[model samples]
Target: MMLEANNNYDKVHFAVLAIGATAKAMHTAPSDIYLRLKKYNLVKELLFDCYDTLHAESIEGVVWNITEALKSRES
Candidate 1:
């Protein structure tokens, strides 16, 4: 589902969604929580290129991660 949210709202929403999706996919997610081992964008990109490799990961992180990655790329 696409949401038309402002900056503050999107951050809050992304945090919530990330945590929830991560929990559902087990403790090995890249969205919420502190990520020291793997970055969110890396895991997200891997999921995109090889979804089979990340069978246990959440598909929802793709959109959120892609958006963040795009923002960073533009910077």
Candidate 2:
């Protein structure tokens, strides 16, 4: 690895070389990280659902046509 991990935090004597030769193991288990990351996609699910609902609506298209006509008249 290019950079070493170190907890030797000191204001005056801090140097990059103080990093440990080996990496410290993560405290959070891999399974926990996987589950949390899986939950993070919940927002994506909601966004896709909204996109589908938007495409299903003819009302917005009607409103858009009226607004576009009004905008054309202003020019």
Candidate 3:
């Protein structure tokens, strides 16, 4: 349905926002951040899966969460 398609679009949009914000906060390229996230499966597991709760959070909060998530995955 149209609603489901819209929801998917919204989630993807939010994911891109988070990636860019996180890249800025980390002083890295968005593409690098995106690749790391994809490597760790965070793009789907963390971004899309948590879209409902994360979309409501502040950009700073989202960036912190993503940074922490990436750090954790590095271990």
Candidate 4:
């Protein structure tokens, strides 16, 4: 469903609805969705760390490792 908002409060309401719909579509609880979001954020952070660690080293290896780590997260 589409929601129209005239103000911040209305926007917040619509955001909540959108989140709920997303959770339902994924067939997971809202808490589970939150956890996945957290995991993705952590992965992003780890990618940055990997980049820094390999900045003076091997770029190809770092990219491979980062891609593997992200794929592992999917499973």
Candidate 5:
């Protein structure tokens, strides 16, 4: 489900969707993904801040990009 971002809530909504989709793809809980995103600040920098670009892609693409970003940032 694609959300049209007209306000802060929409951005938040999209972020949640992205997190949930990522979690599903990775076979983890949404809370885990949320924590990881928060830890890396991707929740803001990538998911929220880049909503314009991310939302234009497919959910699968978004999940792939997010997972790749997470992997790249891993210690």
Candidate 6:
């Protein structure tokens, strides 16, 4: 369950990173990039759901999983 949650976060973060990189390469403003990214707010919500479901064991675990996933993708 935890692994699944992590994977969900990974997928979302990966997409965001890819989009951000593309926007940067295109010389787009970060705000404009974010505006486009906002279309995926639903995806962010779904990721939260996955975290809640898998980390029912502890809120901290869920946060940690998501943080790790985002850090992995961003860095």
Top candidate, metric TM-score: 3
Residue runs of model 1 more than 4 Å from their true location after superposition: 1-5, 27-75
Instruction: Determine which window of 10 residues in candidate 6 has minimal summed lDDT.
Output: 42-51
Residue range 3-64, candidate 3, lDDT tens digits? 99999999999999999999998989999999999999999999999999999999999999
Write model 1 residue lDDT over 1-75, tens digit each, in one string: 245345445444544454456545455554443252135443334333444333344556544554455446546
| lDDT of model 6, residue 1 | 100
Error at 46, model 3, angstroms: 0.6
Which lDDT tens digits does candidate 5 get at residues 1-75? Answer: 234435678788888899999999999999999999889998999988898899899999999989999998885
Rank order (by TM-score, best first): 3, 5, 6, 4, 1, 2
* Cα deviation of 49, candidate 3, in Å: 0.4
Error of 5 at 46 (Å): 0.3
Instruction: Mark the 10 consecutive residues where model 2 has the least summed lDDT.
Output: 15-24
Each prediction's whole-model lDDT (CA): 0.45, 0.30, 0.96, 0.47, 0.89, 0.51
* Model 2 score (lDDT): 0.30
Write candidate 4's Cα lDDT for 8-39 as tens digits.
Answer: 34534433443344456557775664455457
Provide the lowest-lDDT 10-residue window in model 4: 42-51
Mark the 10 consecutive residues where model 3 has the least summed lDDT. Answer: 19-28
State candidate 6's TM-score. 0.40
TM-score for all models, in order of appearance: 0.32, 0.24, 0.97, 0.37, 0.88, 0.40
Query: Residues 1-75, candidate 6, lDDT per residue (tens digit)?
Result: 999888777666754654455456547764554554355452355344453464353434443444454445546
After superposition on all CA atoms, how large is the RMSD of candidate 5? 4.2
- For model 3, the local distance difference test gives 0.96
